[model samples]
Target: MSAPIQMVLFDAGGTLLGTNTDHPRWYEQFFVEACAEQGVEVTPHQVDEALVEAAREINLTHRSSSDEQVRFFWEHMYTWCFRRLLPNRDAHQLACHYIDRFEVGEYVQLFDDALEALELVRCAGLRSGIVSNFGSYLHVFLDKTGITEFFEFVIVSANEGCEKPHPEIFDLAVARAGVPAGQILFVGDNLREDYQAAERHGMFSVLVDRYDLHADKPALRRVKRLSDIAQYLPQ
Candidate 1:
């Protein structure tokens, strides 16, 4: 028989929290608006294209995990996107202007179901923690959202020098979880990063499908909201 889950580790951004805006393409929407603020008109599709290329460029050449490094990474990403969208404009200046406009509350929000889910974990006598591919500021973000106390630890990519789909990061999380991988339940929104990686590491995995995006994959275990996590807990 499978071991009963003793701990629950979550992915932060999409699982427990989300972008403040309701737009499905929040990243592209923000950049499209950013372009308009600079007197350039660009479609969301255009911004999405630029953003994708920028992400690829940054990932291949300039990946970093520290607080400052993370900031620098985004700045460069924005700069790349701006350069593509506004050929005649100063990309660095535009990037900095948009970056300065970010306010924590305006950028992120705790999901409606997150609190009840965490409480469920607590009431189940299961330990909870976070394993996320986030910057060093993630702890502060969690604190600002008032959910920091729920987690025993928050392992961030910036602090650990590795990110998900990579064994090293999962190793750190499993070590900190203080249980055999099979005794942990890993929940996250990403397929490869959270679900497949955790499964490969021997942890039970559940995918969070807030948008019902993966209905075609009927064989995968998933929940539409975090509150549904209770069904997976030991009864």
Candidate 2:
């Protein structure tokens, strides 16, 4: 079944690593805290709205896979976000500070079952890679979190000039993976981005509902833990 499953491609943030939920804003909480730590307090609501704005604004610009360009895109986004609360000059510098501190792995947390699933992929002789709508930060975060070695390679949207829910990144992953689309499985937490996107490309897809956040979610199949992926592999 499932073309014998030769390679596995996973989404990074929710699928393997997660933003520590010590606060309700989730990742936006970190931005709020990052600024507050600098004696610049911005409301969580402001940061959340601005974060969404930043993503939309940056995506409207042109695309590039160059690492430096990617970092600049995000830095520009940070500036856009901070400016919503601070003056132009303050916002630029604050955004810089946020990026510097954020790069140090201050908020990334790995899911409990992530490592075991990756190890099983390796042990079962399947190649593995991480494909995420992230930037170079993922490379460093994974290394500092001690899970980088498990991935044969990593494909970031910033590194590929495309993001999920679009076929560009998936096509790049397929080419880089060197496997037929049917022989690979894509795992992620988002239904549309991971499951539907990969499935649309002829690859198998699984949603890892590690927290059962979507027990009643419709039309999508999911597993409660990352390690459940082991059941899908050829034994």
Candidate 3:
């Protein structure tokens, strides 16, 4: 028989919190306006296309897990996009402007289900923690969203020098959790990085598919909201 879960581990961004301005074209519109202010005119479609191309190029060459590396990665990617859109302009300046717009406290908010899920874990006498593939600013987001106290520890990729989908990072989290991997329950939104990664390490995992994005992956355990995670835990 499977071990009873003793702790609940969560992924930060999509699982516990999300950006307040969530739209299909938020970045495309943001870049369009940033370019306009710099005496250049670019359409949202142009911005989107440029970003897609830049991201593809950067991903082939960059591996960023540290906070400084994450910053540099974005700067490089956005500068590449700006250069493609406005070849004659100071692309680095435009990239800086775009990055500054996403100031920590202003961009993210706690999910409505976040508190309820944490409370359920606490009420069930289970320990709780976080394992996120985010920069060191993960703590700042937690504090800003007023959820810092809910977790016993917060493991971030930026600080650990590794990110999810890697056994090393999961090894670190498992060690810090102080519980056998089989006795820990991990909940997150990303299927490969969060759900499958945790499962491969011998932990129970629940994919938080808030938009039903993984309906085809029915073989994997999943929930539409964090509150529904209760079904996978003790009474």
Candidate 4:
């Protein structure tokens, strides 16, 4: 008995794109290459360990931290990883290089049904956008994947000075799309961050529970495939 969906906002990482288990290896390789540029010797495994530890700490702090704080933690870790690899090089510059490479090379393939589902949404006259808690370079990743044009709006928390689970972030996306909260439908992999926040703003929400982990949550609708969204549309 809910209102029909007119707008669909998506999450970037786990929802739209999947990453391989070896994803961090790209960062390790980049660190090795950057160190080689400085005439330093380092192994990919060493850089991998440093980056992993740093990422773990960042995620730990990010659970209740601001986007800037999370960025600082990531940058610090990248700096430390670079320092470990190149004793004589500038950590900040090397971190920048490694980040650039990681952004370009570290993504997993998009789900096979993503594009078809998006097209169906468009064909049904529903607008689409992306709201992600990612770094500033997310646009580059979207463009590289050729899915950027399909989205009418892209909101990254790093650019907005806020992160998900914050009502303000969802409000910003709703405002940008020029749609009322009641008409928007947000789809994401996280139950709390995407669904609960959108619900707070009077928006409909669908949780992409690919792992079947919280199947018992009664307040929200759970979908295993992007194409399942069509069932929720107006007849």
Candidate 5:
């Protein structure tokens, strides 16, 4: 068997924190509030549907498109959502306003048990950090959620100039922790980016399978509850 993990690295969005039901509602409310500020009238449901359609289109085209192209697709979607919701406002300004509003505290909510699990990990003498694919505001979100103190490092793809599934980002993270790859444990929801990449780099990897999809993969250690992680570590 492999040695016990001395350090733990986490994927931010789906692994450490459960998705909030308010996530979809936040987008809808932001657009509705922005429309009200602009003196435009539009229903939240209509705007939310347009945003979802835009996201689907972007996801479908992402694999074939360059980074710039993907960004353009997102911009187009934002512009369309804004235009549909507030006909009189400039879409660019509206998009910016939406982003500014998004940076505020009410949009994201942390999972109920996340802090307890994090505390348990910390008390276990394992160093912890976050490797997330997020924009510049990730630190702000973490701070607002009151969980920022638990992490020794926070590496965002936007700041690192690279996203996951790339070995270099993982290399950077390992380097930041000042630990050998073999001594680190990476837990994330993505099979390719989190589990495969970490395993490829010689780190211990845990797959958070909240969906119960891949039960037969013996090479991967799958866990549903974040608190159950303590059981996998050696005392």
Candidate 6:
């Protein structure tokens, strides 16, 4: 009963591009390997705790600035986490190594359904873009993964000075696409940030419930993979 969507916007990170954040070994193994080289043994719990606190602090501080000074800020966050477990170790040096690895796609993981879904958007004659809470330089990962050509633009919260749940960012995305809000479909992983937020703004929203995270929300539309998006495309 709704118009066919003219555009499809996707969230980065968990939706199309995923990393070791969900994979436990990436966390435990990474620290174990790195620390082993220095003759130290650290548990995954210790590293995870430090990272949780560091991320919390960064989230709090993120409210103050929306400028392009992301590198310096992230460096501090990385150092903060590293220092908690490696007090006598070179936290700054360790942080730099980790960040450097990220630059070259050290642990970057692309979902299986990502490419097919993106291609489906193109073949369906719908324009596409990415709306992400991620920082800048996502283009690098996009390029390395061979998906950069699929998107018309990438809106980053760091550059935009605001993130999702803030209507202005979605408003700006719709405006940039030159499409009416009602004629766009947004797909992502978060229940509140991606699904509810997009729905609130008049767009058709679908949640990617890889883990059945929102099964209790009976009224919501859910897809297990990006390839499953075909059912929701405007007919």
Off by over 4 Å in 3: 24-48, 60-62, 85-89
Best TM-score among the predictions, by candidate number: 1
Q: Could you tell me how far off, in angstroms, the CA of residue 136 lies in candidate 4 after the best superposition?
A: 1.7
lDDT comparing candidate 4 with the true structure: 0.75
Candidates ranked by TM-score: 1, 3, 6, 2, 5, 4
Give the worst 10-residue stretch by lDDT in candidate 2: 58-67
**lDDT per residue, candidate 6, 37-80, as tens digits?**
66888888887887778877765534412534466766876788
True-vs-predicted CA distance for residue 229, candidate 4, Å: 1.3
**lDDT string, candidate 3, 11-70, tens digits:** 997889887645445567667766787788898889888988887776522244788887
- Candidate 4 regions exceeding 4 Å error are 22-70, 75-100
**Model 6 deviation from native, Cα RMSD in Å:** 3.0
For 1-235, candidate 5 gives per-residue lDDT tens digits of: 2776788898887676543443435557656766777787778788878798767665531221233443455467778888777666688776755555555644576766568768888888988999876665678789888899999999887667777877778999989999789889888878988989989999988888765667788667988667667776656
Model 2 alpha-carbon miss at residue 138, Å: 3.1
Model 6 clash pairs are none
Global lDDT of each candidate = 0.85, 0.81, 0.84, 0.75, 0.74, 0.81
* Model 2 agreement with the true structure over 68-164: per-residue lDDT tens digits: 7656876788888778856535877777776776667776788878888988999999899988987667888898779988888899877677888
Report the poorest 10 consecutive residues by lDDT, candidate 6. 60-69
Q: Point to the candidate with the largest lDDT.
A: 1
What TM-score, computed on C-alpha atoms, does each candidate reach?
A: 0.89, 0.80, 0.86, 0.71, 0.72, 0.83
Local lDDT at 222 for model 6: 94
TM-score of 3: 0.86
Show model 2 residue runs off by greater than 4 Å: 20-24, 40-43, 52-64, 86-89, 210-216
Between candidates 1 and 4, the lDDT winner: 1
